[model samples]
Target: MTDSFQKRLNFDGNIDEVIERAANNYSLGNLKHSELMTVGLQDYNLHIITNQGEYVIKVFSKLRNVENIRRYVEIIKAALNAGVHHPSMLKDMKGEFIHTDEPSGLSMIVLEYIRGKTFYDMDRAPNSKELKLIAAETVKINKIKFKPSYLFDSWAVPNIHWMYKQVNKFLDDEGKNLAKTALSWYEALPIKLLPTCFVQGDIIKTNVVLGENSQIYIIDFAVSNIYPRVQELAVMSSNLMDNKKAPLLRRVERVKQAYLAAGGELTEVELKSLYNYAVCAVAMEFMGSYHERYVIGETADEISYWMQLGRQGLKEGLGEK
Candidate 1:
């Protein structure tokens, strides 16, 4: 739901109201300093430094309702229980997980602030040991199960034809032709239906934090959903590939080896199919994010960059030139 190039959307509501609510709900002794973080692409995150401790007050978009808010909180709690590194939510005075500001009409959640730095800021990829840790943690996270709500389960089973349609919508004639060719390969995959598990659907580097204790923390499960375990590999492949600057096959091989070494299982066919789907996943994200920005007469450097890499991945996946 967030584009790389899109400007940070801020909350139209008064910051004071949100701060007061957090201060009251979380029992922060006094408000020392409140800073609006411009890093978030989707939500307005306010870093509140109070006399008691630091906290992050996330004001969600109007698109999220009360029920959805509760579901998100539930999923995070479940992930934490399964040993995933993420901040725990702080409940309000009424013992409510979700808080709604009547004036802003936007829902908010306060979380315990963890002192860390995101991978994006570090400007480097995870080493082999770190990769294994990430893979192991992901395996544990998938085991934490929940019944998927109707709205939350759709991403589990992706529709290739629908993706082609979406990709075609924003591309020029030549670009559409390239996408069509790539998607044909994705359509031909014999993807086995694996058991659905809890996945942190978006595992981009920016969403990961390395704590002061050298512990790797995976944050931002806002995109979490029930999906075939292999689907997690699809997203991981995209993250590891890093738009093709890194050695794609080597990185994937190492990651897969580490994952299996950590007691994770994947059939040969499933691995191949997921790598193919990984290309399609990149195309789908391009259409949804940068392409949407492109069609509207905006800068599309990111879209063009990813398209070059995705096209290559698709070709390799299909054994075609």
Candidate 2:
């Protein structure tokens, strides 16, 4: 979680009132039950069970710019058109997807509640069949036609260098060395030569929901944007290749093959950069976690899990095992 989100969690304001006002915009009967979700890191997700139906009200944090939020909504529309399975956002009374609360100075959007298990909830990696479906959906997502915006997300793969620079000063000696090596590998890749597309930059376990009938639904488009096309594979492989019985390279090959089977085209440059990008993805995650813990004053225990994953991933990427 980022510093802004931490502050939002501690906010003493009446959030129920905010939820009530936001729900008033939609004719969803009356709010019967509402629960604050603990999964997302960027926004305040309130699960509301109204008299009509269940829905999720996502209140944007202060870190989210309104323009970027609009872009996110647009991306979700594009993803749906491209045959990606995900929750749909509902328009308010004014037929607008986003609603801003004047009293709290917060922007929010309501999406249909998806009843399923996330990979986080399941506590397991996607099985072979699930991985193939996820890859196919990712291909569809990459093929969606959307205009690029100047939205800046620190977690984006293309911004790995910049993120390293920002978080370098806060790392200890071991972390500094690990990040430097990973950055070197990232910099050596022919980044400009690779293809670019709108990617779901953060496709970790929590953002993916496994619905009924073996359907896979992707949620949380907060960090989705234009980037090197291979980044989609890189992000997915790094997070999903958790099978202890398989070699790392073999696991990555499974991801690549599934992607290719789904009609995803990859250039030679993209193939070469895939491993490097995956490694750097882990490194970037580490830096972000470090930034939260050291720079943002979050407890080391809060971020220790990510730090351990980062260190282990960097070693695996560097063939230190």
Candidate 3:
């Protein structure tokens, strides 16, 4: 996707056409499997059936630099090798994730087929026993080197602040001020946030899958960022906001318990920081929802309602003075 335009991805205009080009690239005839397309908040995801299997073809018009995607894939591969329950790398095949310039000079990446439904599609949280396994797998990734400074140019602080300004500004002056305030809060945090551990940043159920073998697999690392352990929890909290089926507060406690049980560390100060970080992260998410609900067009609500919980947590945990 050349990205001469804005947030939209597929350069060819229609997703079907985009998939067609991908199908042609793979020399696939009209695939026996039905075309699968799942649209993320900001990108268009296409799944094309191939002789080998289903392959994910993702497009992003705005970011001409596909290096972010590359780094994430590498990180996932590293995490997988380091024991994160992630998709196995497709060796020697250009199918894991292929970045290419379209005829229009747009950019895209095709990922290997990961066959499984998202955890969100599951009827319930995988049995309590499964939860322990998931926590172990997720934290294993968090324990590794997730320094996103390597992706600063490709995607990092830029995406965060940009959305805060451009997207969140739509809400209100308070929302605008909240965005600015959150950034400063992170900058002036009491504890020194670690940068060594690799973090997925996106921990929503939808991004995770429980494979047929009862194993867990996390895919879609587009939002993956390198940050500290507590910061990782902040991102995870925001992800839970998008989950309306279950009460988020309960899920957080469970996930936190599971994470700690898996040997992840959490100091008292870190817990307090997590409150502020979660609030900041919540405000940031509302800003994103502002864009999704108003600017680009979407029906889901992810802002103020979710923010209210975060704000309350901040007030209670930080002690309103």
Candidate 4:
């Protein structure tokens, strides 16, 4: 097994024991078979097959703040009511979505297993139709009015400056130059004047799953927060436009048009700043992944992938392509 997989398996206690305790909190019948999903870097996701049905138990890292998890749950509930196709959070025996295992001091939540394949699982870019569906769903999420009390998220687009500061020193000279260019464009945007809303901040391919009947489900709201609404399209653009087979500008326009059709209104300032924000989003991912790989010692190959995309996004945004 690769080091990345080993890192994912490196939990504190017995895996079966932890699953049993967490599953006991739910009314889901006996856990027939459970497998650790090697998906995300931060959380330990278990694809558990219960006699009642299928469900996902997300065991959050100790580093995650409980308050943030609570806020994420609230945002998800609101998003669901607004017709966003997100997996339903399952309430535990105590009528709460978050269940704390007293022994491990780890917080876990059960969600209805989305029966589909994430773009990551397919290892391909979302097609134009899928991109439009993603844009429409994002509009539904941004339309949510309930804002969490905590609005400061390191991964939010507005915080790119802060993230840049944290990761620039670790970046090489070429990486630094690309990041600086993206930052310069980001700095020129009228961020304060742009419309703000609760955005599904991370709209990357991995967080989007193509479900049965072509329904698209957005998962993993760990980075969602209130931000300039345009950041939604920006994040989507950065991820979707990475495909070299299609013209980047065409993909960008498609998502923008879809968002507008789905009741999203972008101001003139936001329109001009969209590309800049998308580039900054790429820089953020690059730097953040660099930090994880170099500083935190994560051996995931995704760091190099982000670096490659960051180079492309920065050059394209600067008209250097």
Candidate 5:
């Protein structure tokens, strides 16, 4: 009840100015060129070319404090030590992981540009071997140990539930009723069957990079948190297996088997709850995000697309499709 919290930075400003300042901070003599790479609903990523090398500059649109950046830096550093492959965080000229522009209130981070193909770009859905590789890599990420921050505990295990409540407030009567039913179904599941651990919450196919020598690199730790490890599996399965063209449950089983083969553990009950968790998780995401866009008075077209997808996915999960 504190506030409707969304993770994205709703930042809009002069990127040319930001890049200029970042060049100074990172001690890059000159910015050879920079371009707006992709604008997702949540983030604006830029492909930056500097005198030294190519880099990806991320400017969070929403306002996140220095402390939040520090925590992510801590987590990333720990992940590195855990033998998890990821792009290195490029330090600023001042040796800081975070750069804050006082006037713009934008927090930026520079990452070494990684060259690789994501699973999304693959010509076809991943075969069993590739799926196993992804699962094994995920296990390696979950193995990293870190002390939990008290302030962050609120967003970890129950993030989906929290999102559902916030989004429920913005839904029409029918939407609210459907969400209630889904939440009721999800809440009744045996989610507590597995213990909590540090999970890289967003371990979907897109965040993975298959690099030279078949090295697997995981990126984007913005939403990683400590949670029931099965929730991690549930979320990832939901992400990778919800395609209508493919055999959803069967493909998910393969992924689950791959995960287990990689020394990942889960209870049967937890496994059975995957779809319910997935439905709620997906619903929570689109609902909260759509509501945010609505409140901000931004164009609803993109969010509407996701809202439709979420609703359809929920219906399918409920065997209504």
Candidate 6:
């Protein structure tokens, strides 16, 4: 493993300086430094504490191009205004997403930090009844009446094919083979079998926070886009599979039933393709692991566990019978 990675926190200053910049952007007073907690990626993550309160500063790696940051902020804003629960809020100091005159040559976005433990821990799964509630809330979010921003008409655009290219380009021979296998599996599946909608894209335990007042908040819309509901479901199911006691397949079925009960529309083809989507999703994680984890190094997340869960979902999603 590369001992030293081009990680975050190249600020070249102490938290006090960061607070100065933040205060200027948010138009706040001098912020005292609080203990910064590291989560998600490798660096650029700090939980600053001032006399006022706590806020999260997530410095984006160059991987997050200008367009990507802009689209994410805009989408999250839309989701919030549309009555969808999400992290605190974010605003771009500059006009939309533009090239920051930074040496890194990447655009940076600032969001109000929302604090909470990641929901991905194995113990985070709700009881049987609570799962139903989670499903209902998810359906309600999907039903939120709203329109997508014109800036990104094609949210899921760089399609799976493009994703494959990304995987192949970075991975070694073994990784490339994994990517190819994943590609063929997804290609073999009929798109018509999967229901379509705006998937949470990168739904994982950490992304969903169980907030105070018994509220559930889903944050991080960077990977979000309009895609097959099954695709999203598969990915979510795989996420839930971290618990060995609670098999991911069972959770998926329960979530599906709950989603349907909560007004999630599903067709025969869509329902059937759910399994395929799950399996293919696992392959995707495996193939993309290089770029996401190894190549990106510490900056990337650990999505390796989801690979097996996704494969398991393939069979379970196909049909329990």
Clashes of each: 0, 0, 6, 0, 6, 6
Compared with the true structure, model 3 gives a TM-score of 0.70
Q: After superposing candidate 4 on the true structure, give the runs of residues whose Cα lies further than 4 Å from its correct spot.
A: 1-11
TM-scores, all models, native as reference = 0.83, 0.92, 0.70, 0.91, 0.81, 0.74
TM-score of 6: 0.74
Encode model 5's per-residue lDDT on 231-311: one tens digit a residue: 677666655544555534555577678888999877677777665666666555456555655655444244554567566
What does candidate 4's lDDT look like per residue over 1-321, in tens digits?
A: 233443443454666787888778888889899987776666778899988999998887655687877876887888888989988889889999899887767788899998899887787778778877887888888888877776566666678788878788888897888888878878888878988988888788778899977899988877777788878887787775467554445556777888898778888988877766776777777777776777667665665676676666666656733
What is the number of residue pairs that collide in model 4?
A: 0
Instruction: Report the lDDT of model 4 for residue 47.
Output: 92
Candidate 1 has a TM-score of: 0.83
Whole-structure CA lDDT of model 6: 0.56
Question: Quick one: best lDDT, which candidate?
Answer: 2
- lDDT per prediction? 0.65, 0.79, 0.57, 0.77, 0.66, 0.56
Clashing residue pairs in candidate 2 (N, C-alpha, C atoms within 3 angstroms): none
- The weakest ten consecutive residues by lDDT in model 1 span 1-10
- Comparing 4 with 6 on lDDT, the higher-scoring candidate is 4
Candidate 6 least-lDDT 10 residues: 149-158
Write candidate 2's Cα lDDT for 72-145 as tens digits. Answer: 88888888888899898899999999998888777889999988888867867798899989888888888888
In candidate 2 the C-alpha lDDT for residue 69 amounts to 83
Question: Model 5: residues >4 Å from true position, as ranges?
Answer: 1-13, 39-43, 101-105, 117-125, 150-157, 169-174, 210-215, 296-305
Query: Of the pair 1 and 3, which is ahead by TM-score?
Result: 1
The lDDT of model 1 is: 0.65
